[model samples]
Target: GAGVSQTPSNKVTEKGKYVELRCDPISGHTALYWYRQSLGQGPEFLIYFQGTGAADDSGLPNDRFFAVRPEGSVSTLKIQRTERGDSAVYLCASSLSGLLADTQYFGPGTRLTVL
Candidate 1:
């Protein structure tokens, strides 16, 4: 089975621009999540979708960040007015179960470099 994957493994963008990162989850997985990891820090949860609806989106830093999982499979993280502080690795994960205890398989990530 195909595991989760992300695009643009590396992205360089100017400050105040917009960017979009994509994620493809594993087959048959119903739970998907997005997280961001800054240098020397653990991944911080951003948003999660169980099926087509966002189950938890509390971790999204501000209005500039948003995500969507329309078909309950692939998801995209869109950032508007990107800033230098937004430079980080955006990771995506999926799990067989939607519960917190379920193990999430992670994607390589899209490393955004906002200059």
Candidate 2:
């Protein structure tokens, strides 16, 4: 019954540091997504997980970004060698299905600041 939720509402880290951002999708949702939003722009898709496997991860910027949804409910986004450019509001969303047309419920997002 709970909506999507992201932990560590704000994160501050230096460049080259590794950070892990957590997300809890809605109960029983089969689809989960991760996005990054920069200033003056809409949220950019990063990855999509259906059940326990990643269905699409083409939106990930580079090898530095990775995400996993083990057991199909909780997910964690891992960033390695963080850079100032990686600073953004990391968003998580979930839908009933992994359909493009399905409405997604979004979380508040975790604001990451890379110094």
Candidate 3:
């Protein structure tokens, strides 16, 4: 009934721990996106999935970060060996379609604090 939503609004973990952030997009949306936003910086696109496949993943810094949308509705972002620099707000967004003019709606985000 609403737009996209993310879970674990705040997460605190040790540097070497693994973390999983979840996102639930609006029903019927064919495009989903994951983004990372540092304090005072704009959200940077990490991975975008059109349907069930990643359309773009160039923004992922390394293999430590990965995302998946198995059934094309709920997606998860996984981080391995988290670091201090890896701390940021993970945002999820969705669009009706991946078309150029399809407006993307973003969720509140999950704040990750790596200690």
Q: Each model's TM-score, in the order given?
A: 0.97, 0.98, 0.98
- The local lDDT score (0 to 100) that residue 50 gets in candidate 1 is 95
Where model 1 places Cα greater than 4 Å from the true spot, the runs are none
Off by over 4 Å in 3: none
lDDT of each: 0.96, 0.96, 0.96
TM-score, structure 3 vs. true: 0.98
lDDT of 2 at 49: 95
Candidate 1 structure quality by residue, lDDT tens digits, 16-99: 999999999999899999999999999999999999999999999999999999898999999999999999999999998698
lDDT of model 1 at position 68: 96
Candidate 2 lDDT over 21-72, as tens digits, reads 9999999899999999999999999999999999999999999999998899
Compared with the true structure, model 1 gives a TM-score of 0.97
Spell out the clash pairs found in candidate 3: none
